[model samples]
Target: MNVRARPFIPAALAVLIGCTAFTSVQADEVQVAVAANFTAPIQAIASDFEKDTGHKLIAAYGATGQFYTQIKNGAPFEVFLAADDTTPERLEKEGDTVPGSRFTYAIGTLALWSAKEGYIDGTDKALLANQYTHLSIANPKAAPYGLAATQVLAKLDLTDKVKNKIVEGQNITQAYQFVSTGNAELGFVALSQIYKNGKVSDGSAWIVPEAMHDPIRQDAVILKKGENNPAAKALADYLKGPKATAIIKSYGYHL
Candidate 1:
């Protein structure tokens, strides 16, 4: 998650950028498979990248697990922006991606959020007493964020106590919806979904401590389909630039 001047210009494109005057890359679209947790910031970054490089991006956002299945079965995505590094690394090992194209783009943060203000009292300590009617979380088996949420509960010794109160979502986006819509009083969700402009937008939340779970090392990789596609490589490169890093940080992610 280091922010550096990485603009994934193809060797041919590099000369074009170095010139004082240059045309952008061809108007080709990159098909990206993105994790649900990154939905907001990636869209913003994609827009900026399109303007700068003239390469459009079409994104499919969902659980990383589902994307893995689709990719293994020949989903035509040129890039995979996973919520965890594990998936991209696996893709590389399985020959689904361009070699040496994988790198962590962002480190994600978790949050315990509620729809109403003043509802969540503190750092999930109140949950030990079973105070809430229902608790929501992404399906741990499918979503890395959900797995991280389970890890936090385990660290706090609340897993067994709240087993029955749990409501699961197919992905992090849906899990956030459960809390945002009052379907569940509270839920564990990616901070990016609830944070903007240096604050939580509409809910009470506790930024889950990093020690509770392993780092959510989100990585991006160019898939085999994009091995020769300049647009796909360029998008992957744009993800490491200052503009993309700034947008990601604004959403409460770290680089």
Candidate 2:
């Protein structure tokens, strides 16, 4: 006599399995707000973080100051990666971030980049010469990279000469885009924006030395909303780890 085996899964058990899978997928996602200057490295690191930890990162990139305002207004971000230490420190002091979880993740480098090969002529003094009709930089009030650009100009004694020629972008990403699109002859941006895979891009660039300005110490912190989130804490710690540091360094950022 031939016999057939009974179906193993009950209808109720199948529904329970589906619900469990959905909850696991939801739990693995972590929301993050990252400063614009760090966009490249963070995108690279996020992929590695997910591969190694099985946690997904949903990152939003913008000016550090703007993100600070949004977080203050109750944006639901579990982690905040800022372009400078000031904003993260302020958040912690205000109790908006998890106290004691703040740390520097990278040291940012500023660069004056021109999409054309020789537009900047390899020196910043050209700004004083007024050889370029328009220069782009992030808004000093909103972006840390913009603050560094302003310092570079002041140090070169060209602030007066270039002040009126400046065209401001809301964030470093836009500043870079302005130059890339030829809307601005040149622009100040984060080195990471043009540096990748252990080399700088084809654009003309003058890397601003660290001594000329206040250090751009990129800091990362867990928000109060993430105080109890294990995945956010894991990512914050992983960013400080060797693997992540290597990826950051490849993009010309110091850790």
Best of the candidates, lDDT: 1
Clashes of each: 0, 0
Cα lDDT over the full model 2: 0.89
Q: Locate the minimum summed-lDDT window of 10 residues in model 2.
A: 119-128
Q: What is the lDDT of residue 126 in candidate 2?
A: 53
Residues 1-255 of candidate 1: C-alpha lDDT, one tens digit per residue: 987887677987777666625344356789999999999998899889989988899999999999999999999999999999999999899989899999999999999999888887657755665788889999988899999999999988889989999999999999999888888989999999989999988868888989999899999999999988899989988988999999999999988
lDDT string for model 2 (1-255, tens) is 999998889999999999999768655778999999888888889889988887899999999999999999999999999999999999999989888899999999998888988766666655656788889999899899999999988998889888888999999999998889999988899999998776667778888889989999999999999888778988998998999999889989987
Model 1: residues >4 Å from true position, as ranges?
A: 1-25
Global lDDT of each candidate? 0.90, 0.89
